[model samples]
Target: MSTAEPQSAFKVKGQGTIYLVGLGHASTHWVHAMMIFLFPYIKQDFSLTYTEVGFLSMIMHISALACNVGSGPLVDMSGRRIIFLMLSLIGTGAALFLFGIAQSFLFICLLVSMVGAANNLWHAPGIAFLSETFPKNRGYVLAVHATGANLGDAASPFVAGFLLLILTWQETSMAMSIPVFVALSIITFSLLPREKNPHASSNSKGMNLRDYGSGLANILRTPAIRNLTLVIAVRGMAQVGVVLFVPLYLVDVMMFSPEGQGTTMMLMQVGGMVASMIAGTMSDRVGRRPVVFAGVTATTVVIVAITFISNDLLFIAGVSVLGFVLFAVRPVMQGWMMDLTPRELGGSATSVMFGVQALFGASVPILGGIVADTWGLIEVFYMLAAFMLIANVLMFTLRGEDAEARA
Candidate 1:
């Protein structure tokens, strides 16, 4: 009998592939956490209206959305993992450095947009890599990858919040650059192997650009994708509302100090981290539909509860539950999307899901701000709760066998 040689060190399988993807996703989580930490400082420094702040955030999300659409096919065709990874690191690091020194709102917005674009470059390729690497266990692997992001989200805010006490916002921004640079160095030197041309693979079925247009058209025509899109859109609106406004609510409505608000937010991240891991693992064993439906329903309940509570401890409890529900379903949803997509259109399908979510998230803060300005912050929470509940109903309608078969 002939013996085959062992695969290379970078040839990850099972848990290791999940870890690799998780590490890449951690960079995304850190950026999100850092942005939350900087929001208060930016608002104070720029003397900006809530609408203006929303617009700046919108620029970042919109830029990310655009990049995801543009980069999807290239990533699918090239299979240049190391190249995309290195570029993301460099671009994000440079943008962070520029952001630290930005003097005006426009400069800040521009830098943030660049950072968002960089992040977009990182995401699609990384996700596709994980999906392909662990085809049999896509949900489990993808969930673990997402868990890495939750870990970063859980930690970064606490670090950023603590740093803010000792440093200026610019210095805090500068500090955020170090991680991406380190991640890039690791990927360049050790973590990622040289990629084979995607066209060379036996699995390759070249995706024409025109096919992407058709794939999107097909996506729109499918009732499942359509409903899922609406569910995610509503969820995205609620997510933005909470992330952008929670601190403000803690400060103005609940009468908390900055430190207190930061601490509470940190707790939310902790809850989110735990929830992401648990939900991902559980969904692998139980099935995607149950996990997602339960999470969304729980999240809606938590959001509604928050509007009626004023005590700090109670509010933190609600936020913790909110965090759990908000993050727990993420992996299941992403897995569902992958399962729904044809193998040939993996990159394009994932990009469409992300694009829709980004567009929805981008619109929410502005709409929420308008509601807050016209009605009240409490009213914003009510709207967010309603959105979540509606999402829950939509998610419940998904066909389990259909989702599984597609995967």
Candidate 2:
């Protein structure tokens, strides 16, 4: 086995950069939360059928799916971290601004597609940066990064909801763009040092379809990577379904107002933030598999319990636990992917994982909507519980050989 050099210590400024990535993640969550807030306004304005709303979501997720693949190679080749970060934030902000002003469904679709594409640019590189910046403590650093995202998720709905109460949906969306714009400016001016692309030597000539295909094939053939992807896919499907419909469940089943729904969603984010931190640290010490298994199992249990809770307070408590279990495992999973792939293919591998998950998540919102329309929203929660249980079983099948090798 090759002996790897010891990684440098994490600097104060480096931690600042990770915080920036967290803020960026928060902005993405804000956008997502804002969308939920806008749904009613959008439906009222356009008289959108359920299918039309579903199609709009499909556009965003599909664009994210495509961009995830494209951005991987771009990040690998350039290693211009700040430039990519700035572009992503600016582009997403522009899309949101346009979305606020968009006059028609077609216009909104186009703008939202742009938002999706731009949002896709953030995760892989931001995460890759966190991984590279804190190589020695990748799991913990990534966990911190994910926690930042949870904070954003927690705040986004409340911000959007507050704006919705005072202003129109378009105005609320326009207001959401301000923080991202500020982030872009900060990134543009920040004096962060550029790090060498870990994968630079792997594809000096740049990535092509054949190269990507081969790399992807290599990833699939690797046992650990294969299992990791399966776990992500299954958990992703259930997570997306619940997240997309949970607001509706609160509104339709529990009879919460929009503001109340937003508050409930915020609670989920708070739970997630706490879980991400604790899980990330624990996984680094104890190993990724155990943390992941426990998290997923706990999540499944919470989802099933949510169906039985009739009191609003009990439901909120259950959902909060669900949030913690759902998000806590993300950083560990991401760290595991990095562990499996060589540095040279990190971006590609990350992209493949995210892209596939996004595609899977894309299907979920629409499917959950359909199920909610036919059965009850409670049925959707039960179905997710069933899926999470299956995912837990699959997770147990994962070998820790890759992680063990790292040790």
TM-score for all models, in order of appearance: 0.89, 0.90
**Which numbered prediction scores highest in lDDT against the true structure?**
2
What is candidate 2's local distance difference test score? 0.75
lDDT of 1 by residue, 335-381 (tens): 77766766556666667777778887888778777887788888988
Best by TM-score: 2
The digit string of per-residue lDDT tens for model 2 on 287-357 reads 78888999999999888888989999888888888898899998888887876776656777778888888
lDDT of each: 0.72, 0.75
Question: What C-alpha lDDT, on a 0 to 100 scale, does residue 147 get in candidate 2?
Answer: 86
Q: Which portions of model 2 miss their true places by more than 4 Å?
A: 1-13, 49-51, 191-217, 403-407
Which residue pairs in candidate 2 collide? 199-344
